[model samples]
Target: MQEEFISSKQNAKVKNWRKLKTAKGRKQQGLYMIEGEHLIEEAVRSGVYLEAIILNETYEGAYPTGFSTYRLAAHVFESLAETDSPQGILAILGAQSRFNAAEDFQQLLAKPGDAINRWLLVDGVQDPGNLGTIIRTADAAGYRGVVLGTGTVDLYNDKVLRSTQGSHWHIEVVELPIETAMQTLQGAGIPVLATALHREARDYRTLDYAAGAPLALVVGNEGQGVQAKLIEQANLSVFIPMPGQAESLNVAVATGILLFAL
Candidate 1:
């Protein structure tokens, strides 16, 4: 394994690593940074391809072997960290292959009849926390995967990654257009259900999800809810019936309820 000590914040490698904090940088470089020992351990446990393991000069913890390691000066590590209380350990990894929309979508479609069971389709969920929570919930609920539709926040965003608490490493997540995802699932005989409050919508509890058919649940933006066009394209629309007086549930909370119930 290669090891290096970098004290200069102006080092070319440090500059490149700092770029990973932005969407454009991550896209351009096809790499993203994850700080904290838990995240690094999760990545290692998941057998993710690690480009390098980075440590604050003072970090004393042991990390996995057989990978390149870098030790950064205190100031340099602080400047690269996203969290106020940064964990002394971090990792750099290649972006997951599933982020390629077209290829991953085709692979989902190619699944042998009903092999794709449950999926969470996210549409324009702007909040990183909400999106991350949804993904984590989906993983816990035994869903097949998550398809992030158009306008959804980037899955690699640091807040989203942090909010997931390492669940992202445990499940399959892909990006695709909402319409395309709906059509593909429907074409494969799976029912697509959109969460919305409309005249035609049914109570979520009333739905028959135990019929052994594959299912896909669509949750949308925190404010706008699911897009009108996507809702229309769905096989059905479902809404949670609140007994108490409240406008609506948070997208993440609603998703947990629906995932567990269905």
Candidate 2:
């Protein structure tokens, strides 16, 4: 369960761990890192594929069994940790296997009795915090899954992971073409609701979301609203009726409002 102590920051293993901070490095290694006991535990509880666990030399805490554990020098651990207060516990996990959106959509529909009704389809959401909150909200609202379109922030980014607060382990998050995902879900009798600021958009409050009615909510970029081409594919377009004279809602806040509305 324990390995020889790692003292050098430039040690081969240490260098590999540091590489995870970059998207290119993560891609090349096909691995990502999760920090803190909570996220590490979430990864284990969710049955995520873990490569190993790393701890600081001074860490005297106990950890869950079943994975190889390594201890690094205090400085080495601090250097690898993204946060100021490193919990001295972290896990290296393989990137989640890619899901085929169309196939997953069909599989979910097949289980009509147990099918998840509300789905969040994200399009070009670039902010890691916004994307993370959206994922967490989707889980809390009991949505089935989240389909992230191209240009959405990487789900495994440390900031995004921290923002989710372990919600990523609780729900399905997949990346796929937005238009294709919309079409597949629609073909299965699910309605696609596009959040937009168009004249024809209906007020979100006027809608009633009944149990067992499958639907997908499409949200877009922080600055620009949903892309016009993507919105054109929605079964309906709706917007929050803000009477307070605010220009618009933060994408995450807007997503929370609309997600729970369903």
Candidate 3:
């Protein structure tokens, strides 16, 4: 490995790391930082392009071959890393397409009608961690794709990427207007189900998973729950039952349980 060690924190690339701290930089530069062998390897296997592979000076081992490689002083690498205890490697990957339901959700938008089914829609789900975890769980359960609505968290945020644990790459994420999403699914004979916190809501487990038709699972904002209009549009309204003392399951946890149950 050809190592380039820099002592000055002001080095342009180091400053570039700071830019990644904001959503704008990530969007404009079309890059995001991910550290650790496991995460990078997952990205690599998914064929996500690496803008650069930056490593600590003392690093050793035959790593993958495909991109620029730089070795900063171990201390410098540690200083720039988002987490404690640097893992001796970091990678800059060009920005990936995130799930936006309204305008740019390519997977479903481009596919033939037969390919459009089993979507997971979100409305104003602002928490990055929660959104990412939901995508991860949905992928594990073999859903078709995700439709992200207005006010949802940035899908490419580092926190979301980390929370997804690599599932982000496997599924499709589209940003779309909620109305467009509903219309798209409804036109294709896919039924929409919105989760609710109300008393009369059907228990999630009791829903007919075998409806055998394409289904869309709609999860709403954290505090506001699903919007009233969405509830009115859904073919079914459901909720997770709780025998425990907690008021409700966190959005991601509840979604996972429901995904598995259905």
Candidate 4:
């Protein structure tokens, strides 16, 4: 493997890697960074094209071979790392392709054979851990993809990435307006279900969704639930029954229940 060493935090490459910690910087550079051995392995297994592998000068662990590698000074690696305990390895990868609002929706609607049978739509979910957990759960439940609606946390956030436990590489994730996503799925003959406790909502278990039918479930913000407008637009509304004293479920927990039940 081709390798280089970077000892100065002031190096141009170090400066750029530091920029990847923010959403805006990632967007500007079309790249993001993932730390640790597991994520890097997942990226390789998933066929994600990695830009470069980064290592702390002192890291003793064996790293993947045949990729360009960079060894940084301990201080430099720590400065670039998001976690308190650095794993001594990280990698740069291209950002997932952004959804083309105008063209991609049309293509998705047109391609019946390529349609994902199950999708999770996230709206206004601000917590990184919650969003990541939701994605991981969706992957576990065999969902095909996740759509990140407006007000959702950035998918590339380090906390979010760590929370996913590498499931981020296993499923399709796209960002689009919630309304547009709903309309597109509905247009494609998929039923859109919004999670809410409105009077008209149905018990999620009561719904008779045919086996393998296309479905989209929307889970919203922790405090507000699904947006009223989105709930109104959904083909159906659903709620998990709670007989206990607890008033509600965590968004991630609630999503896992709904995903597996439906």
Give me the candidate number with maximum TM-score.
4
lDDT of 2 by residue, 1-262 (tens): 6566899998999899999998889989999998999888787888889999898989888777778888888989999999988889888999987676678757765554433667899999999989999999999888878898988888889999999988877777778889988988899888999999989999998998786677999999999879999889899999998889899999999999988877
Q: What tens digits encode model 4's per-residue C-alpha lDDT throughout 1-262?
A: 7789999999999999999999999999999999989888888888887999999999989888888899999999999999888889999999878574835864755655433578899999999999999999999988878889999999999999999988877877878999998988888888899999988999988998776878999999999999999999999999999999998999999999999888
lDDT of 2 at 21: 94
Candidate 3 lDDT over 40-99, as tens digits, reads 899889998788888887878556665778778766777767776667888888876664
Candidate 1 runs further than 4 Å off: 99-104, 112-116
Candidate 2: how many backbone clashes?
A: 0
After TM-score superposition, the amount by which residue 40's alpha carbon in candidate 1 deviates from its true location, in angstroms, is 0.9
Ordering by lDDT = 4, 1, 2, 3
Candidate 2 residues lying further than 4 Å off, grouped into runs, are: 100-115
RMSD to the true structure for each prediction, in A, is 1.8, 1.7, 2.6, 1.5
- Per-candidate local distance difference test: 0.88, 0.87, 0.79, 0.90
Candidate 3, RMSD to the unseen true structure? 2.6
TM-score of 1: 0.95
TM-score of 2: 0.94
Clashes of each: 0, 0, 12, 0
* Every model's TM-score: 0.95, 0.94, 0.88, 0.96
Q: Which candidate would rank higher by lDDT, 2 or 3?
A: 2
lDDT of 1 by residue, 136-225 (tens): 999888787899988999999999998898888777788889888888788777889999999899998788767445799999999999
Question: Which of the predicted structures, 1 or 3, would earn the higher TM-score when compared with the native?
Answer: 1
